[model samples]
Target: MAKLYFRYGLGKSAQLCQVAYNYFEQRNMEIAVINAKDNETIRSRIVVDGKNVLVREPNFDLKPGVSLYEKIYLRDSDVGLKCILVDNAEYLKEEQAEDLFYISKMLDIPVIAYGNRLIDEKKTSLGVCRLMALADDIEKIDMSMPSKRATLDFNYGAMNCSKTAQLLTKDQSLIDEGFKTCIIKPKLDRDELYIASRIGLRKKADIILDLDDNIYGQAEYLYRDRINHILVDEAQFLTPRQIEQLRRIVNDYNMPISCYGLKSDFLSNLFPGSQRLLEISDNIYKMNTVCSCGCGANFNVRKDRFDNYVTEGEQVCIDQGDNYDSECALCFMEHVMKIDTASRKRVRKK
Candidate 1:
């Protein structure tokens, strides 16, 4: 049976796609590639087996137009008759994702989507969320490094460091050292900024913030295309309404949608969208980030121009007014207390 495959990971999906492509090509099967507009440009330059293969751009404007399958097949009859391979398949809109899924199922052709599991720096796996419901086969490729001492200035003696340290230590000695040695928690503020930047570079969606213009159109497109599996990135930023729309695509259309993004904000507070995702999502996976002290960094802290911790600030601070770092809850509390003590001393001096 044809199945909608959502392969999610950090660049691992790309490796998997390469493997899958090789497997089919070994059988001398023909493949057609599809991707988002931005990816299509770069994907066109990718040579699979030295065959100048190009991922065609998806035409989102389906109004008064023929179906995507008909359009592609009409342009090149070989695609409809032969096997197809899509790179960066996660960039497809809901309608496009669903359409490809249906083609794989009804036509008995395998449709594979390669994409990141998480969309944010927190390493929340968006691809995993979207694929869990639809995937018949799921494989996790761990591309993370071993946890080590952090470069930040802070104490992390009481923070969590077991899981990440274990990943770093192949033998018992390193693991023992990791546990005994204090490690700093990973900083969330800097990570979120990095994520936002990457999204700016990779996202091809015309409607990034305006849901009515882009999201609804994408949803309607997905319904029309009959997509089987949906893959989404930066899902943490998705509004509650957007999540509901995705849920509707899943429940009403019976399409499985996977999303990736942070579960919480820099301040360790749940993002409105992430909160909804936690409630609605079927499977949850955590990617690891280590604090400067070499411990698991769970909380995000903002800093000012003097590198002093700022507990109260705007939720989104894009301007580089000061530096930021990731710290453990314990460290964050300590900083908070220190700030309070300093304020009290200043009052006394006055």
Candidate 2:
């Protein structure tokens, strides 16, 4: 069965050239290489550690237009084309992507597309997004780390692990370095326009993300203002879709985004937004804190006014009756689960 494949990454052109080479190696395998960027020739380099190991130049160019499907159909009919390979596919229009989808589905010809996932570093490539949506299969080519590009970073930790402090420090450092920065917080976290740390440091956020806010659109607006970096606090309050929007902003605008939040709720269950960030973020950092037992804290523990461990409650609570603390896994099991410890008894259920 013919399949439409969308392969994206930083240096996907090299993979496209390799695919073309492999196809040429097979006898009687004819393929058409199209450059969606209208380049007369497609050049690809296998770079390792900032050095080019091999270079592949495929001499073929097909200017994309309304007649693209007709041209491919005619070629297949005349020469029995086995596959169609497209480079710079991020430049493809939505209509062109749909045309390729139909070409592959109707003619039983495999279409493999390679392109950067994003264009400007702040906006997702709509053409690539469309192809990805329509592709039968998707792949990512992880080229050697290219030059330092903007990245999406998720810095997670238990309560009082200084995640917000780190976010604030990073944002301020970037500002001190002459880079414009933006601070954003989910409205679900608090009504305050500023993000404050337990240690008495706070900064007014430039943007407050409502539940239905479009973070990517916000990033585009920030890009126009020359905002170089974005720091997000209480990111766990963001929805999973918002995390994706943050990722798209990083890729599209080439802006760095650092998100600070708890990875899990007090119940030790993953938060949807935090889980999404873990899945897609380019970098993940654990902000370390110590439990009262002097061990590394890995869980957030909620408590009542009397400091009894809270067993269950709503996932989100801010400035509420309960207080929160960080605990090591063993302490969590001992204090909350009342297991393997004679020192403290679990609070009786009401």
Candidate 3:
């Protein structure tokens, strides 16, 4: 049966987005998202805590005294509105809260309202109070509690940190634990459809993601085939949109994902993929590696086959007669950059 649910907390908008993603993913149905802030501002997208969600303004007027229930009821037949999600519902008046109640109860459309629970430390929001009284289900959206939601973890470090090896081992462990797993890697990293580490560890990837592929769509198909976990190798090549799609996949399907990659390029600039993963991942882990000088490595140094430093080139170059070494900051600056600077000075002098 369709019901009204009120989920209230400090930051509950993400949960609303999750519901919207799931409804569309599972049933191929789109739900209406209503921003109840009564600002008359039309927006194509809403930004919630640095994340973007596509949205459209409701068809009917949302003036201060208008009845939302009547507007939704009148348009239900023409628009086929089966579900409704309310954002910033704390701004809703008591009458509007009742309107949502009637929309859910009489019209038989499910309504989920997300809002802050309190106006202050001691008082509850008026709209939240009315919904709390009228809604069929109420949930406190607490992030501190233990949850079964899928985790997005980033395992990153300099080159040859055993990142891919750990990825292979984790995939095997998950399979041994009876969790069905799928491995994927960016096609930009290699031509083959498999990931191989220097330690002789290799695994065939189920998907080789191209630059423009929709990761969520691909994952939906894999989810239908009973794949529960996803492991990504060389994730540094992933685009920002792809990382957002991975975030959506986990929220909607509760599918765990682990990404292994270098945190930065040879120039010490963060790779776009690694930066995005660091921004949004649930957990961050640094895989440690040692430099040849016996210090902990934190940077990548590029060198030609002749053992001379390749200071500047394309950001990504593979199998191009160049080698990459992990080095500590001091050694990299003193051994590579210092010598390269001297060579440049001599060339300019000539």
Candidate 4:
């Protein structure tokens, strides 16, 4: 069956794609690599017959009222004309993705697209989500490995130094200097590196934290090592097309994949990526967190600049000091009612 394989991982999706590449190469199949402008790792590693191949991004600017397909076809006639391999699959827009999907079906050429399942904060798959839904078969590569823990020491204020020093057998130094140094050893648990920052898209930190490395690594590993399992963390940030690419990865490749992430944003609204995952995921599971009230916290609440409840705002806010609270729907409603009541009272006093 014509399948779209989604090998997902926190940093392993590209590895899976690499394995797939190896599988096809062993059979001497011709491949085409495509990706967005931002993907550098996969772009660097693309080789044909043990020789590096340069995959250029096609430039197609559609004029007003022009069709996207026409623009794509104009730029690269080979899209549907021949068997092609695509890397950096997330860059394709929805309509473009649809065109590619139909092209694969009509031409009887296997178009393997490898890319991340999620963007940073959007759940919408860049390219793979749509492909997964439409593909004849699906596969998921899950790599949810256990994390390690360690302890590290930090400096604390003077008052607790003597008591804290007692915990340590050796007296490194005890001068009773004006400044007191307390050692604080905190247990550090292993967490996935959130490459993308939760800042504005245009911010430098956010750009630097892009997930291109994770995607490329997973694809490379999969193509080279024949690994199948894939896992994606913080998947709520994926774009729609990226989610489609993930779906295609599973449906077409027959790889079982697991994705871990928040289901909604700080506002309790579904991110595009999370929404897509909910729609297309074969198995759904919820990782639980609790509210201060000890109730199951399924919703997120945001606060305004003045630390007041903010019911409406932009989809995402990056400024620190903006308070966020996780609550259940019931508690969220109560807070909303309270805010409303407070507003009414203020108006009456005025």
Per-residue lDDT of 74-135 in model 1, one digit per residue for the tens?
A: 43343333545454544445445544544543454666665544444234443334333233
Best by TM-score: 2
In model 2, what lDDT does residue 71 have?
A: 68
lDDT rank order: 2, 3, 1, 4
Q: For candidate 4, lDDT tens digit of each residue in 1-350?
A: 12233333333334535544564456554444444434334433546899655333322332334443343443334443233444445555665555554444333345555555555535555455554433333333444653332111111111111222232222123213222222111111122222222331111111111333233323443535543444443455556456566566555555445555555565445567666775566554444456677755555677767868777777666566777666653455457424232232122111
Q: Which residue pairs in candidate 2 collide?
A: 120-252, 121-252, 121-253, 121-254, 122-252, 122-253, 122-254, 123-252, 123-253
Give the runs in model 2 whose Cα sits over 4 Å from its true position: 1-146, 341-350
For model 4 the local lDDT of residue 318 reads: 59
Candidate 1 has its poorest 10 consecutive residues by lDDT at 150-159
User: Which digits, one per residue and each the tens of the lDDT, describe model 3 over residues 1-350?
Assistant: 36678876545666666666677667777567777776333332458787566444443456776667767766675566768888777778888887776676456689998776555433445676566545555555656876777899888878889998999999999999999999989988754777888989888888888999999987769889899889999998999789989989888988889999987777655677876775567766778888897977767889899988877778898757888988865456556546242232122111
- The C-alpha lDDT values of all candidates are 0.45, 0.75, 0.74, 0.44
TM accuracy, model 4: 0.37
Q: Which whole-number lDDT from 0 to 100 does residue 219 have in model 2? A: 73
- For each candidate, what TM-score against the reference? 0.38, 0.57, 0.56, 0.37
Least lDDT summed over 10 consecutive residues: which range in candidate 3? 341-350
- Model 2 scores worst on lDDT over the 10 consecutive residues at 341-350
The window of 10 residues in a row where model 4 has the poorest summed lDDT is 151-160
Using TM-score as the measure, name the better of candidate 1 and candidate 4.
1
Better of 1 and 4 by lDDT: 1
lDDT winner: 2
Instruction: Name model 3 segments beyond 4 Å from true.
Output: 1-146, 336-350
